[model samples]
Target chain A: MAREGNVVNLVENFKTSIVMPTAQSFPAKTVPVMESDAVATSKRPIIRIDGVTKTYRNGTNALEKIDLDINAGEFVSLVGPSGCGKSTLLRLIAGLGTASAGEIDWPTSTYDAKGHPMPDLGFVFQEPTLMPWRTVFDNVYLPLKLGGVKRKDAHDRVTEALEMTGLARFAAAYPRQLSGGMKMRVSIARALVKRPKILLMDEPFAALDEITRTKLNNDLLHLWEQQGWTVVFVTHSIYESVYLSSRIVVMTGRPGRLSDDIEIDAAYPRNEAFRTSSDYGEYCTRVSAALHSASAAGDGEH
Target chain B: MSVIATEPRRLRLLPLHFMRSETAGRWLHAVVPITFVLFLVVVWEIAVRELGVSKVILPAPSVIGEALAQNWPVLLRSLAITFSVMIEAFLLAVLSGIGMSVIFARFRILEMAVFPLAVILQVTPMIAIAPLLLIWVGLDHVDRALLILATVVAFFPILSNTTLGLRSVDHNLRDLFLLNRATSWQRLVELELPSSLPYILGGMKISGGLALIGSVVAEFVAGSGSATGLAWRIVEAANDLDTPRMFAALFLLSGLGVFNFAALTALQHLLLRTWHESAIRTER
Candidate 1:
């Protein structure tokens, strides 16, 4: 029923964007709808990226004419080489920075009095970014606390988030007392406690060991399935993107632009078995080739 | 203990590592320094007696002790006066310095306008300024002059350290606060103040010692005109050629300085033991 309301909001957003003065610059065919879900609902994308470009203060063009849309409940990965401005795009989506040109529209989200969309969203950075001074429970409770929930009221939700991250036992422990993996779990719990509609992660498990990263990947998939939230993940790993994403968007550097879009076409509840499957290897190879050609495209343009 | 005692040779061989236990290390820290000081005192007493050193030049430790006992009441009263002045100066410095740093952090322009003058005051020797302060405040307000001098001496470290601390918030944490839509006041209280605590405590430790030194310097400058503080007692005893009394007063002043430092250190440990890298035990 809520999904029906989202469809209505999407139409309204589409109308507004089309009426915008700069809408003529956007290509007509760039509206992204997931292949599997397109036939099922014809539901509009939750977030629309239309003709977006970002240039830094020193005249470096970080990203150029980015046009993509993220459908609700989709797991999308933005994979690119280093300095490719994928992180910049993720930050722009998170509203951490302003777009130099064009706009990102979050159609289904509510706006504050300032006309900026209020964050019903969570962002997990490459670093764990937990407060060293706060205990695990208190760190997780921070979002609720900032949102005007008293500590006593937030206690249960805070505990639930910790339990989800398998960190219930360490709720009383300080960040310094926890191992690297445990600290990252605390960071995840903090991001999840608010139960946001969108979860934007930028290489969240990149610093962990392969075994820990794999375990976290499984855990994240479990949470995403249960939570039913849209995840736009950013990573440098092709295998990670293939194993996790419903669709992969490949980007190239030197004024980053999207060069390839491929659907993984694999069933979820992915495990260690799926990781070792031949199907996984084929997808990894396909994504790797896409990345290779994208870099080549970047070179040819220069 | 019995096993080590039975093997005396083993005890000698393992002597260095014997204080590995935390309680044993703590005991050594307290007992060893006192024993060394006592040993020095005993050596001094014997040397002065053997060399027939003039009592006027270097009083024996026993004679200084005797002088301390005889003038205990007067010394205690003088100590009380000095204690009050030092406490008032330290408290004033703490409140004003922290308050000023917070203001400076909020208004960088004000910090720029005032910081150079602060540096000028800090670099200029307090001794040279004490007499002028005495004249400006007038000799009748000698206690006020003493407090102003001490506060000026102790104020700079707290102001500078706290200002640095207030600005040293983690950039990622700052972003988190922004994302949370934290009001400016909430950010200051919940984030900035707690983050600055260790630096503030460190500055307070240095400022605590300086407060005592400033009080003494002020008293010395005030001279016989204000004869209530220990420094004034020292000056008076020196004028009368009472070397033992002077040594006794010096002893009390040093004792007070040590007490002030130890108290501040304990407070720092209490506040930061669980969180700060400086205060936490690395082992666990």
Candidate 2:
């Protein structure tokens, strides 16, 4: 009876706090526009990458003259061939590395009272990268713990994230005990627990089997629909970019630069039907053509 | 529905089967070696008796048992003395070694300056230095000389192991901590220390046995009436041609080594049993 009572209470609280507000705020027709059109409009840019260039100390031109404007609540994908520096670009946007030449500006800064930038961005690495020593709960609890959120206060958010990621049954499981897919779920939960305004995922589902990847892609879209955070997903897979992104930024290889920005005008709640539909295949083909040319252009330069 | 009904029953029986196997395995693990050792001892006793071996050359187990029984008080005192020295040196070595490792991890320049010296100390024979330590500290404080010698012997493994462990943290994990803006202290305590635990425990197992050896060897080098360790007893027995007493003291020394190793191993298991791959028992 006590367990049932707790479940009911959690559901009620979660509905009131998370579900109801997100449902109201996110209507069915608020699809994000392309960068070229978005720049002309009055929607405030979340991040502006202005002429950003990164040349490493080892004389490798990782990324060059990359300029992009990311609008709020957009699911943007950076899709390119290997060695295109897409991951490098994502790392720069996350402030993990500094761009050599240009600047990354967050027009609306999310800083705490102490003037320290409160971490408002979550990064999901290619690997799950969960702390093997910590339990799923503790691993998810890490960001909040680092940000000085007390355990008593962090418990609800962590539980909600776990539930969202479908890992509620495995809160006590260590990463080593988990399957590869489950470990990645724990990683996603850890990233989402912070309720960050922007989620930067670097090929998060790249390592999983196709079935698991599809399942996770669907789950991710559901969460994105529920919680409208800006997502910047980096991947080498054309189908993945076409399936997930509202706008796919195709990048060229070595000395990586933006080659094309293609917008997918498909409606929200893209599902298995969409995957099987002619529309999905058309988008994938278009993006694949763009990627093919991008790689071809890269080869000409070398 | 029937399959679901059978699943819970199978799950319930699973742990029961596992427990029975575990208990039987533990019994076999303990009993088999002890029975073999008893068999060997019995054969040894019979061979010595049947061969009419001179007691002065090689005493039988019964005669050594008699010597242990007769000189229980004296032998026990000496055993206590040896253990105390060994334990004190071991504790000191562990503390200083770990402490120095932390310091070295923090300061690269300091590690570069002193790590070679540590290696030099480790490779040099403690037996060669024990007599010098006795003279430097003076024969009046022979215990201190033995303690110093044993600590030197035990220190290097823990230091090297802990240092390697501290440096061996996963590069991606370090990047994660850095991205989170964790302080150096937080990184060391939460990440580096935990990752290093298995290595430190491995070093402790080696150092435990070495500590005992160092103390006994020091006692042999000290070679004084005031040095009342089991090793000293062996020396005294040898000079007086008490072969049975010498064998009894040697037996006690070997037992001490075994006990020390077992205790440290149990400690390693207790500390690492929850998560570490080394401590977890795999079936295959």
What does candidate 2's lDDT look like per residue over A200-229, in tens digits?
Answer: 999999999999999999999999988988
User: RMSD to the native, candidate 2?
Assistant: 11.1
Q: Candidate 1: where is the Cα deviation over 4 Å?
A: A1-43, A297-302, B1-9, B13-18
Clashing pairs in 1: none
> Which pairs of residues collide in candidate 2?
none
- The local distance difference test score of each candidate is 0.85, 0.85
B28 in model 1: Cα distance from truth in Å?
Answer: 2.0
What tens digits encode model 1's per-residue C-alpha lDDT throughout B37-108? Answer: 999999999999999998789999999999999999999999988888888999999999999999999899
- Candidate 1 clashes: the total is 0
Candidate 1, residues A189-300: lDDT per residue as tens digits?
8889998989999899999999999889999999999998899999999999999999898888768888776777789888889999967876787677678867876767
- RMSD (Cα, Å) for all candidates, in order, is 7.7, 11.1
TM-score of chain B of 2: 0.91
